[model samples]
Target: MRLIEKVWFRGHPAKWLLVPLLLPLTLLFYFISALRRALFTVGLKKSVTLTAPVIVVGNIGIGGNGKTPMVIYLVELTRQLGFKPGVISRGYGGNAPHYPYLLKEDTSANIAGDEPVLIHQRCQVPVAVGSNRIASAQLLIEQGCNVIISDDGLQHYRLARALELIVVDAKRLFGNGFLLPAGPLREGRWRLNKSDLVIFNGSPNTELWPRKLTTPNAIMQLTAKVVCNIKTGERITLSTFVQNNPQVNAIAGIGDPQRFFDTLSAQQLCLNNTQSFVDHHAFCLDDFSHFNDNIPLLMTEKDAVKCYGFSQAHWWYLPVDTRFSAIEQQKITELLITKLAV
Candidate 1:
């Protein structure tokens, strides 16, 4: 998988062999994508205009581009501005028994997907997950939310959005610059200019972006917040956990697992080893069978939700929050205020 990914993000000999086979499929993807947008633009497809203001947080390419963290950030920020904001997501890997499922105390990641469950637990706000963004958003409005934040549905033109924010992985910006199989993008780079704001994850310097991304943009940093024992419910600061070079084994099942590992390494954790799983991989007890019970195991908060049911005593998860520099932070806040006010 990593080698195939190299074909998309970086130069690979495989790209020569793979691109020839994938180019035709890529062209087909672009045609379908372009036609889809054209239909919406021509009014052949109707877009649902909701009562509450809708803010869409998404990216052009697949994989986690810090959309979940941005959604969480907006939820917190809006509440501070006296707006009751609720969230809606497509629930990518989840199979809920019903449509527009509002999260409850008993909701599992398997039912709501990892991100929705994490957001609901972390923000303590109403979150509705389903394939239908309109229906899921309506549920949030029914819950008395004045604002709706869609997790990742920029391409879902069926739902009319009041504000659009696109998140980009600063390190891997539009790998191979192709759509679908030939590369790692859902839409072309041209779409970035259409968004109200372009957010760059893992990057706090906005000047580093390319000229083509002409929209107002901001850099986002994922800062580690709390380290909590999955089984004990005990919490500690991230700094405290890494004191004295603690022996930690890092594991991640996220879009960029290496990012998580790099974060831990920056904190000076003496990691015994690391494991990377496919994004949103379901967790079971047997997955950790080889780890020594004496060493502490660390994982991302997204992974924590799925492992909590059968987590071991030595297992801990680190929760991270999105952050921006003071200047950029104010810029984003002001931008949101202006856009949402409309």
Candidate 2:
């Protein structure tokens, strides 16, 4: 799968021969996506609404755009404003009973998906996952949640929302700007104009649309908060880890492993070995066999979901926190208060 992504992004020669067939398939997908959105817009299909406002954080492109951290940020922001925020997810890769189930640390990623489990662990708030987000939202509300944050529901139009936040990878913005099979977009770049807000995960870029959330919105920036040892449960600054490190092994099973790798490098930590796993990969004993206790193993918190039972003393996890500019934070607070009022 990694090879396929590399080849596709690199414009491998094999893609040219397949383009004849892929072009038609891509067009079909685009049309179907557009038609679905059209149905909801025209009132032909009903979208489920909640008593409280639903703020959806999602992307048109496939893979991660720092949605977990963004969700955590929103949760904290709403909590500060005295609103109880709950989270709902599709549990994309999980195999739960398909009914809305509340999340716990012990909940397997196989049942709640890695992202939802990570959110549940970090936010310490109500979290539910199922195929039907509307049902999940209802469950959270019944549990006394006043605000619902749907993770990665931008394209899930069946779930009505009061605010929409489109998270984009500043580094990989709309890869080639073509629809699926041709490129990475599930929706076209023009569709972004409809979003209530646009968030660039990394540094801001001028090539794409300017960063702003509509309907009393503001621009937020992200930065690493802290890194900790998964096995020892000790906090370590990226600077200290890099400076005092013996040989180290870096492992990342997130949407963009390179970004995490780059962060480590910025602190002068040159990984003696690096392993990239598919996003949300279930870590097993064998996955860590390559490195012995002599070498420290570092990973992201999302990857830590599947690695909770790991007893290896050398393992560490970095917890990153996202912070918005002062003005942006104020705007988000005001928006949530306004929604609660409504």
Candidate 3:
């Protein structure tokens, strides 16, 4: 684990050495963040409210806590409700050939980043990626997208939003509970009180919720049952795949790699070995040269987006879907209809 992650998530004597130095910077980050939000709030700075209503699907803590899957879920839901939804993202780890780049069927994850490409492929919706979300959102507007769902821009006060949906990692609820460098949060817990709804990814231990702020909350679980070969489009039930190939090597480059591995294990896939990488690691073929090719290699769908070009025959990826209870789904649907009036 990285030293900062140790400082934020683990109780280590090493963090005692590191936290003091990072505290000052953490304070500065909080001050600047608060000041920026205040500026937009008091009208000292301009925030562009787009023509189409934007529902931001984001999180307070850094690292992936299933925000991309939530974004994908919303895309499908809005489409069912008869609205054309477009997605905009920061496109971290990707430098597109141009700004306000719209994704095509042939667009590479290396260009638009893995998450956006994954969402586009999963939902078949227009997705725009750029640092300037206003330009990205506007581009979607030009493409006739009536509603916009932002994937991880909760702190970007410049782009006004209609509804804010935050996805929290229920297992790691705000490590250290401090903002930025000293902790995992981009915003503090109080930010949750301001959101339209809070979605806890994975089973929630209700005790972890900060006491008293009533922002209606729900649960989101991921269900994965199919695995597909990356090189070819052949699909197989996870059970069949597991029965056929017992020597599986699982690899994940996500916020919580262990969660992916654990999910695979829970699904009865026996693992010969496991590997984890930093979230959104720009994958290349050289990264896999050290691995044994005889063993079946399994990975998450998010990682597969970046590996399609050089995927080996033994490589496969598990695609997960967001699973919400009937009541929760109805609640979200009602909120979307009322919040966006679509």
Candidate 4:
């Protein structure tokens, strides 16, 4: 594991020694971020207001806190409530030649990004990606998307948002409460107060967040159901999967790999070996050469996208869906309707 990762997630005492050296840089980051937000607030930077209500599901920290799954859930709820929703993303790690690339059913993950493509595939909604979020949302609007769901744009004030949902990792929640290199937070903990609804990605850790933001509107749990073979698109229940492959090599290239591992453990999947890579790590065929055909390789739905072309049948990805209480769902739906007045 990386040193910064240990400081951010594992709470290693010794790894925090770099705080003194990084504090100056953190201060610089904070000043710049605050200045940018102030500019937007002062009308120095104009925000684009879309015709449709833009609901932004994002996090205050740098890495993923189940934003993609939350986006998928919102898309489902919006569709059920009689709204045509489209998703826009920053397309991190994708190297598409053009701006505002509208994702197709057959768009490669390398071009449209793994998360955006995955959203398009699972939600069956129009997805557009670009560095400029406003451009991406504009493309979606042109495609007849009535409601816009921005994948991760809480801090992207360039696009005026009707509703903001901030998802925080319940366990890691704002490590050390410092900004940037000194800690994990992209913005201050107080930023949560500005969100329309704060959501804990899992069970809340009261000690992590400040007293006020700790009280989340709802909590989300990721429930893994079936393990699917990426190469052949064959899915089997966890119980049935263990019957055949009792021990498997589990790999995750996500923001929080241990969370994925813990979820698998909860599902009673027997993992013999495990490996984690940086979030959005580009995978090549050589990355899997060490694994033997006899050993089944298990991964997450996000990682499966980049490996689908060159992976073998032994490679399987467990697809997880976001789950929350019906009461919370009703509350969110009601809030959405009230805000957008749909």
Highest-TM-score candidate: 3
Per-prediction TM-score: 0.96, 0.92, 0.97, 0.96
Local accuracy of candidate 4 as per-residue lDDT tens digits, 136-171: 898889999999999998889989999999998887
Model 3 error, position 193 (Å)? 0.5
Root mean square deviation (Cα) for candidate 4 = 1.5
- When sorted by lDDT, best at the front, the candidate numbers are 3, 1, 4, 2
Q: What is the C-alpha local distance difference test score of candidate 3? A: 0.90
- Model 3 C-alpha lDDT per residue in residues 1-342, reported as the tens digit of each score: 566876787766777777787889999999999898899889999989999999999899997789998999999999999999999998887879999999999998889999999999989999999999999999999999999999999988889999999999888778888788878899888888999999999877757754665899999999988899999989999889988987789889998888899998897778888888899998999988877899999999999999999999999999999999999999999999999986
Candidate 4 worst ten-residue window by lDDT = 207-216
Best-fitting candidate, measured by lDDT?
3
Give residue 107's error in model 1 in angstroms: 0.1
Model 4: residue 190 alpha-carbon error in angstroms: 0.5
True lDDT of residue 328, candidate 1 = 93
Of the candidates numbered 3 and 4, which has the greater lDDT value?
Answer: 3
What is the lDDT of every predicted structure here? 0.89, 0.80, 0.90, 0.87
Candidate RMSDs in Å, in order, are 1.7, 2.5, 1.2, 1.5
